[model samples]
Structure formats: C-alpha cells, structure tokens
Target: MSAENGTPETPAGSTPPTGPRPEPIRFFGTSWVGHDHGYTARRIALAAGSLAAAAVACLVLCLAYQGLQIADIGSFVTLLVVVMFAVCSALAFRHTWAGFSSRPDPDRQASLRGLLTIGFIGSLLAYAFRCLIEAPGEKLHRTEYEAARARHEKRTTRRSGNPKKRRRP
Candidate 1:
C-alpha cells in the first residue's frame, strides 16, 4: 500500500516473521538454545556418570587381566592381549571423539565395528571427556541448526512485494 510494490508492508515496529523451531538435542531438550532449564546440572551429572562407568569397566578389565596372570597363561600371550586392547582403545577413542563434530564414513565405520566393540571403554571415556568440556555434539548441532534456521528465514523473506505488478519486457 506504500509508494512501492502493491503488497501490504509490515509496520516498522512489528516483529519479523519467525522461522521454524529448532530441533532439540537428546537430553538437552530445547535448552541448548539458551543454556537454561538445568542444562549445566545435566551436563555435570552425565559427565560424572560416564566417567564413573568407564572407571568401573576398566577395573573389571584389570581384574580379568589378573585372572589371566593367575591362570598361568603364557607371558607372551598376556602381553599381546594387553597391547591389542590398548591399541584398539586408542583407536576407538579417536573415532568416537571425531564423530561428535562430523559424520564418519559409513563404510569405514562398519569395518571398524569389531574393533570399536572390543574397545567400548574408550568410547565411554570419550563421551565423559567431551561432556566435561561441553554437551556431546552440542556445538555441531547448534551450528547446523542455526544454519538451517537462517536458510529458512532467507527463503521465506519477501524479496518482491508483487511479481504480477512488474512491467512486461
């Protein structure tokens, strides 16, 4: 109705149109947007819980190793078992940590399933470590969600007031 395109213009004091709501992250609900509603407490609890679980798992593994020793298993075989677990754990930790920020190759992930399964403790440790710093995958999800919101806003914005009112060539 202004001296521009025929479509009615929004009042200057009115709020802009909102984009779609963000998808919530697990255990975070929608609190990640503002870091409110017990977000900090949940992060602390999860971090401590995961760390404790990982510690307990390690203790059980240690006890198993001791049983191997007490069984008079060959020293060479015991050492090999320890080395294999250590290497596998290291690899699993790296993979799990990297996965928080990026999507891993499915083929590679499938190939590593056995190794990862054998090194579950490492994955737990990685989760605990990341939770201590920030909610697991929070940053990655926040960035992607924000980008999607921005794209939605851009796409929905009225670029032209009325296409039908344009002059023909």
Candidate 2:
C-alpha cells in the first residue's frame, strides 16, 4: 500500500493530484477578466506613455543646462536642482503608489492632480530657498565690483582732448 499509488492504495485505489487553483479571478470590478488576453495591450500602452514623458523631461533638462553654464555658480545650482527634482519626483511617486495600494479602486485622476500640485509646490520652494541661499554671494560680488570701480575712478584722472602746455622745449 504505497502512499503514491494508494495501494491502500489498491485497498482503495487513488492517483497523484496536480492542478491550478479552482478559485475565480477578479479584475477591474469584474470576475473572469484576467482570462482574457486584451489586458496586456492596455499594460503596454501605459508603459509607453510613462517612458515618453520621462524621455521628454530628460531631454529638456540636458539642453537647458548648456544655456545656464555661464553662471560661475552654475555647478552648485545645477546639482541642487537635480537633487531636488529627483527627491520631489520620488515623493510624488510614493504618494501615488500608496494611494493606489490602499484603495480597492483608486481615483487615478485625483492622484494625477495631487502629483502635479505637489511637484509645483516643491519646485517653488526649492527655487525660493536657492535664491535666498545665493543672495549673500551675489551681494558680496556686486558690492566688491562697485567699490573697485569707484576706487579706480578716484585714483586716476582722465586727460583732456586739448593740451594747454606751451610747445617750447
């Protein structure tokens, strides 16, 4: 009476078992939706849209960086901007993911609105902080240049076009 064969098995014969779950799938508020093959298409489209948005943002940032290179403090500013951008974006993504995981059916539009709102606020705050932090450097430079120009002007006198001295030598 082997356990595999139920030779107890033949006392009462049986066979080995193998099969998937008997339970039905529930997708998008409807059962049996997972059985259909069309969901993959929807998933692909979603992925493509996300990739396109990311590509556009990256391209814009790279091109715009070249124009900003004239600033002496551009490297520090650029580093701050990039770090802030990444952090804010990560936070927005986290908020949306949490919202989605908690809800039976999340309000996607609300998530989008929230994401945009949060991003704009973060950008504004970062810009304000950067400006405030950089003010001292700008102020010092402006005053230094002004003072140097004033000193130079006072120390040296400009020559008149006409010479008044007699030419006898």
Candidate 3:
C-alpha cells in the first residue's frame, strides 16, 4: 500500500500504473465518463431520431397491412402475419435490452438473427429507450473497465520486503 494515498504503489524499475482506459460506447465515445463533449445533447438527438424512425416504419407497416386487407387475403392469414410480427418484435426488444447489460451468447444471437431482422423496429425502439436513460451498453463496459483497472493495480503493486535483509530459505 502507498503511504501517500493509501493506494498500492508500482514496483521500482517498472512503469507507473496508468488507470485503465474506458471502452467507448456506440455514439457516446468516452464522453460518457464525464458527460462532456455534448454527451447529453447527443443522447437527446439519438433518442428523438430513433423514435421518429420507428414511427415512420410503423406507418409503412400499417400501409402494407392495409394493402393485404384490400387484397381480400383471408382474415386468418392476415391475423397470423400480424401475430408473427408482434411476437418477433417483442422477442427482439427483450434480447436487445438484455444485451446492453451483459455479453450475449454468440450462438443464441446467431439463432435470433432472423427474428431480429424481422423485428428491427423493436431494436430501434430499444435503442431509443436506452438513450433516454443512459448510453446503451454503458453499464457493461463500465463493469469490464473497472475489473481491468483492479487487475492492473493488483499486478503492479510492489510487495513489502527488502531482499537483502531476508534470510535465505
């Protein structure tokens, strides 16, 4: 431990430990750490932009559904299509939201690719939702960065001993 600050000291002859650098979140960069460089403004813009895009997509989907209705497609078929899209969207939203908090399984993500593609609107909505609160994936990146800093501190800490004064073992 260091006498000056009660923190561990780096070993002599070794470079001093610099704190771990934070990994950048999408669209936020390192600004999330200090909320500098217009982070708040960027968040607001992204949230609004994504929400507007989702609204436009919903309108397009509504038009397509109306087209199907005009074609006299069987009621059962139209209902099934609607249900499928709804289920896919809900699943995509949940998956995307969970991914922001932790590393997702690659195989699972791969399997969900089709569903996610079909329900891209849900992903956009999730992004907007997260931006309103915090940068997406910010928490997970912070956790990993903290763990790395701890590891660096542990590795660089000097052991308390004088080799010349110790008895040979």
Candidate ordering by TM-score (highest first): 3, 1, 2
After superposition, candidate 2 runs with Cα above 4 Å error: 1-32, 35-37, 71-73, 103-169
**CA RMSD per model (angstroms):** 10.3, 35.9, 8.2
Better of 1 and 3 by TM-score: 3
Q: Clashing residue pairs, candidate 3? A: none
Tens-place lDDT per residue, model 1, 19-125, is 65555667766676777777789889988998999899899999999999999989999999899889998999999999989878999999999999888888999
Stretches of model 1 off by over 4 angstroms after superposition? 1-18, 161-169
Question: Per-residue lDDT for 1-169 in model 2, tens only?
Answer: 2323212222346655322212221221111123233334433443454555556666676676665675556688988867766676666555433432233234665656655453543333333332333321233344554566676666666665557674757
Error of 2 at 117 (Å): 5.3
Worst 10 residues of 2 by lDDT: 24-33
Measured with C-alpha atoms, the lDDT of residue 118 in candidate 2 is 37
Top candidate when judged by lDDT against the true structure: 3
Please, what is the TM-score per model?
A: 0.80, 0.40, 0.83
Please report, as a residue range, the 10-residue window in candidate 3 with the lowest summed lDDT. Answer: 1-10
